[model samples]
Target: MSQDSTVVCVVCGGPAGEPVYASDRECSITSLCEVVPSPTVVRFCQACGHVQTTEMPGIEAYYDTQYKILIESEEEDQLYAMSNGQKVYRLDHQARTLLRKLTPSAAARILDYGSAKGGTLKRLLAERGDLRVHLFDVSAMYLPFWKAFLDEGRWATYRPPAAWRGTFDIITSFFSLEHVARPREMMAEIASLLKPGGTFYGIVPNTFTNIADFVVIDHVNHFSAASLAFLLRASGFGNIDIDEHAHTSAFVVTATAAVQQGTVAGIPRSEIARLGSEVERIAAYWRNFSSCVREFEDGRTGRPAAIYGSGFYGTFIASCLSRPLDIRCFVDQNPFRQGRRLLDRPIIAPEALPEEIGTVYVGLNPVLARAEIAKVACWSGRRLDHFLP
Candidate 1:
């Protein structure tokens, strides 16, 4: 858990300043089931107010061959929310948000960089048939899914063709930056791929909003507003807009590729100190999370329980348990995850959960855990104890 002084900030190329959080426990990846037991150390850059983790070994190979996100089926998607008793999926919401933010002109050339399965772009194309869309990613595992909507010429693996350089009007990345160890390099490539005055739109996790991101091992860079600005400016982007509240636990950003490289501004000392303090507070939370969960379990030993989400939080809860066998199943509202298995426990819908289970661990975002759990009408009259994060 020692800090590597040679590690530089991905945004500003400054030395990694100080260690903020370090852990030796098994950490979960974005693809919930994958776990890394190696020690994790997070460092904060004083110059740019950026927080980043030590890169995972063989991270490139891992993402290319091992990482598997929502690839079960073409219809599978993460649950965004429950709108008036209707299930709203994530891709649909993302498409709506992007369209509202930037409406492309007819026949505009657009590419979804690091676009796994190109779900968001597929949804967008369905709305605007005149827009020309392309897909790019490191892995070819999702090529089958992309083939359904895009022609072979419109998609590429490893890297896009040289002919694609400076040809795109719009480039979008959806929750891909955090996983990359060299974000600055990635941004430079994105800039080269765009025409002058072209826009780069992206969504990255906001660790300050979603504390779980602080401990996710696969997320190499944990971006702050200041760090994001630095990244875009250093990569020759201008007219940048970063909106934190546009999406839950994410930052929505749009930056235009400038004809000339933009000047990088120095962060204020006061702001650096403020960000450092905030990062320390979040680190302390994860340091004590396991102990808190253990204490909660101690009070209800021998009682059968269920986890209320099949994502990262739920997997983390199971990892912290003293007797994981006590948990009978995982309850999820998303139909895609209902029939799956996490930690050898069946993931069932709320209505399908056995009535004998007396306790429920709400393994969801702490900011929305309680309210989401309450929305399940099936658990209304049942005398079940709920452990909320």
Candidate 2:
């Protein structure tokens, strides 16, 4: 994709500046680590300081037909953390966060927008049985899972029913906004779906906090606090609150519907420059990441290795290596991914790793990758080498 000057910013109507980051490769991997012929080119809007990538061709069809996340099982969930020897899952954390932020009236209507499998709402309902919940998504693939907890009349696919407008007391979106190509239109739709003074609670990845999101090919929008504020205010939402530190690498936001749409103010030029410089720094880091992995592989050629973490980071490490076959398998803590195969290599528990593998490639988030690897007691005393990003 060319970095055309005429490319428009999704957040602000102004033309985007020059490309902040562009991939030389013709194909890129999705967050799920599936390879596709979509080169990434990220740009920032000088008008609003919003950083975003050009939408992938046929993105709508891609999500509707090809995008499947964590669908291996109904119990599948991302591991949030290991707290005192117990696993804290993503869905549990999301439900708790939402409940802590807002208290709904008895039997208040709630909708999960862009809900895939509706896992978070299912967990929420477990805590509050009195709530009336609904689910909506672009695809019908997850209807079977929704059928377990939701009535047939409570869920819709593709477009929501027109009668739903101005009926919901609370609308929630979890990790959905960043994937959208047109966020303004989505925010408008959410605004229209809510009752008067209804709440819109959602979460989006914070690129500043999670550096990995900056290069994820499927994440079209990299929202900053300033840009999120602009999106909500311009979309007829008031009482906006964006919490950056509430969740790791994500911004938890809550906004109330307003009677009149508010004007979006121009971002300061100095603030824009600051955000631009930070984006460039992150882009440079990723540019060097591939080379770092290749150099590591070159020195340890012919040695048996295993990649830890089967998500995007681990798949990226495999993509960088000239000899991917050297990797015997992948190690992950998530039970849902343990039996799966990435690059034809089986994913297994860390304890199930072969004894012959002397080196391990840590393909987790750079922020916590090293610490997580260090916590693996099974690898301790084995004199194994670990290459952490």
Candidate 3:
């Protein structure tokens, strides 16, 4: 597979870099049965050490309907579910830290870009009642959530009047940039929307540190610390502060819009080499992972099996395996998805997982997956397998 020369590095406008992975199989954010196949190719940009794919086709159309369906498929009250193991539960802690570093201001106009279901904004408003909060997302499916919980005057669906330009004191994009086709353009637009000296705080997957992010089909851009800094600076941002330790496998950055165009720095030679090595390492890991999954599936051929966690990790496993596993059901904790069918397999809640299921693949982030599995009372004596390290 070859890189499209016309599509340059999103951060530096340099040449399309190196190909890291290509798959002819379907690559959809949703499950295999629900989506049509769109072949995927991921590349590594040496210019700024960013990893991205060729711009996806019909991205707007896909996000409008398919993405909205994905949101609706989840529990309606999931945003408020602050359970320890839930995905967005940590957003409360993360938001508190990011907001504290902000310069104290009265009635600050804060916008949460890509605020799906308005969860972060809800948490923010609770912490800072004085903030004039706003919400924007591609889909309006969460409008009811906004109407019920947020200030009526604050929310819009990516349509603000011309007068609203450069009016915001702070803008945040959490786990949204990776899904965008043109990250540079997205950053520039956000810069234009902010007041002079306005801060932009973003959180994206730290691919340099997390291998799992590499295969996430929905995430087009895999940003490292260096890549994110370069993209922010090129988009007229300065006084940048990036924290890789504040969150696991994510880069939390705080940048202010500069009065003039910000300077762009080159990626270090050592850093470039390291990124290349990491790319190879991840590719190797995927090959090994596929082989391991196949072997495990073969060993348990006659027995009924199920996968835990129907989110990204489990969905990726369902989508990528070459040989079909005898997966009878998908075990998930989210109530909305419990009765849905994914990959032609019924999605059941943990309590619904039958005793006939001899083995359960723990398809979740390895760090806390074991503890999460232990919490399920019914799976106490069943065999558990780990697919991720």
Candidate 4:
């Protein structure tokens, strides 16, 4: 990221002159903090309102350096546990939901472009069952983890059975477009990979959630639904639809039959700013309401005897349980998430739990938790008999 070079902003095609700053190295799995020299940071495009870094790391470099750190940071810190984790409804249900808006059979091969460990793909295949599935990510580390979720013969990748080229029905990227140096190129690649009538369904972060921070930090390209629609048309996608999923602060875009790249579409600059403000207002309200409903409790026990799981619902449950229970620890099974703290209380793995003082209030659907725990090899014959009327 030397100052002598110039790069184009992926969002607006503006020139980002030289990378100026770097991000702190982070590992998502262990939440370890290792301070590093700042990498180069870039500026925004005045024409299309795209902000990007001047130097885009190679995909290989991306995986080894910055990308791994970002991911490992989340895993180490149990970030998804801190925030409301994205939940997967069955893939069939997801496909059917989209089919209501998208042509069902028009999508033959489904690829989740930013499929992190294939959660979305699993849900899609879980529903459509017949579609050939492919999961793509810049990092190979997550592939093995995601593969466990796929049926033996159902999923493949870019390094696959050779017949997958240009044969997809739908390609999707959920919460993963803003980081790329050339999103349009990525889309074009996706388009080239798609059959003409094929659709590309994706989501990019807008001004939702902690996007303001993410924009300055993890993300390089942010898009309003309109701006993203314009990006799609430029990539030669038609029948483009922009839908806002407000809570995550993302725009879900569906484009069809992308044969020729179109031009960049954007509203007036003032409108983009106004859209940001409006979304911020809605976001503030959502946060306030969530705060009101989630109060940390003290159940007289020192440990987290209340709340649900260690992810989103767990955070809510624990945050709320803190209001009534003496939640000293948060429980989870993911080794990467154990030993951290949410709202200052320690997060502990189930294996790390000691004999409780008394009482356990479940948050992640009591029935589901009970069933899942029952399936655990160690707890198979155990009775959860701590709570009594």
- Candidate 3's C-alpha runs over 4 A off are 3-6, 24-35, 73-91, 150-153, 321-325, 334-340, 366-378, 383-389
Local accuracy of candidate 2 as per-residue lDDT tens digits, 1-389:
47579888899888988898887677777877987787888898888889998788888998898898888789999988888778889999999999998999999999999999999999999999999999999999999999999887899999999999999999999999999998999999999999999999999999997888888899999998889998898899989999987778899999998558646778888888899888989989888888999888878736699999998899888888888889999999988788889989999999998989988999988999989998988888786778889
Pairs of colliding residues, candidate 2: none
User: lDDT: which candidate is best?
Assistant: 2
**Residue by residue across 1-389, what tens digits does model 3's lDDT show?**
66555667776778766577876455544322244466656788887888886556777876665665335522343222325655454557667767776663888998888877767667777887888888888877778878877766777885655666899999998788988888888898889889999999888878666666776666788887788888888899999899988777788899998558836778898998888788878767765665676666666545667888776667766665555456789987867678988778899988888777776777776566777777887766666554443
**Candidate 2 wrongly placed segments (more than 4 Å):** none
TM-score (all chains, Cα) for each model: 0.97, 0.98, 0.87, 0.58
- Order of the predicted models by lDDT, top scorer first: 2, 1, 3, 4
Stretches off by above 4 angstroms in model 4 are 1-7, 16-42, 53-60, 64-100, 149-162, 212-216, 259-266, 269-345, 348-389
Question: Order of all candidates by TM-score, from best down to worst?
Answer: 2, 1, 3, 4
Supply candidate 2's per-residue lDDT for 149: 91
Steric collisions counted per model: 0, 0, 0, 48
Candidate 2: deviation at residue 46, Å?
1.7
- For TM-score, candidate 3 versus 4, the one ahead is 3
If both were scored by lDDT, which would come out higher, candidate 1 or candidate 3?
Answer: 1
Model 1: per-residue Cα lDDT over 98-120, one tens digit each: 99999798899999999998999
Candidate 1 has an lDDT of 0.89
* Pairs of residues at least 3 apart in sequence or in different chains that clash in candidate 1: none
TM-score of 4: 0.58
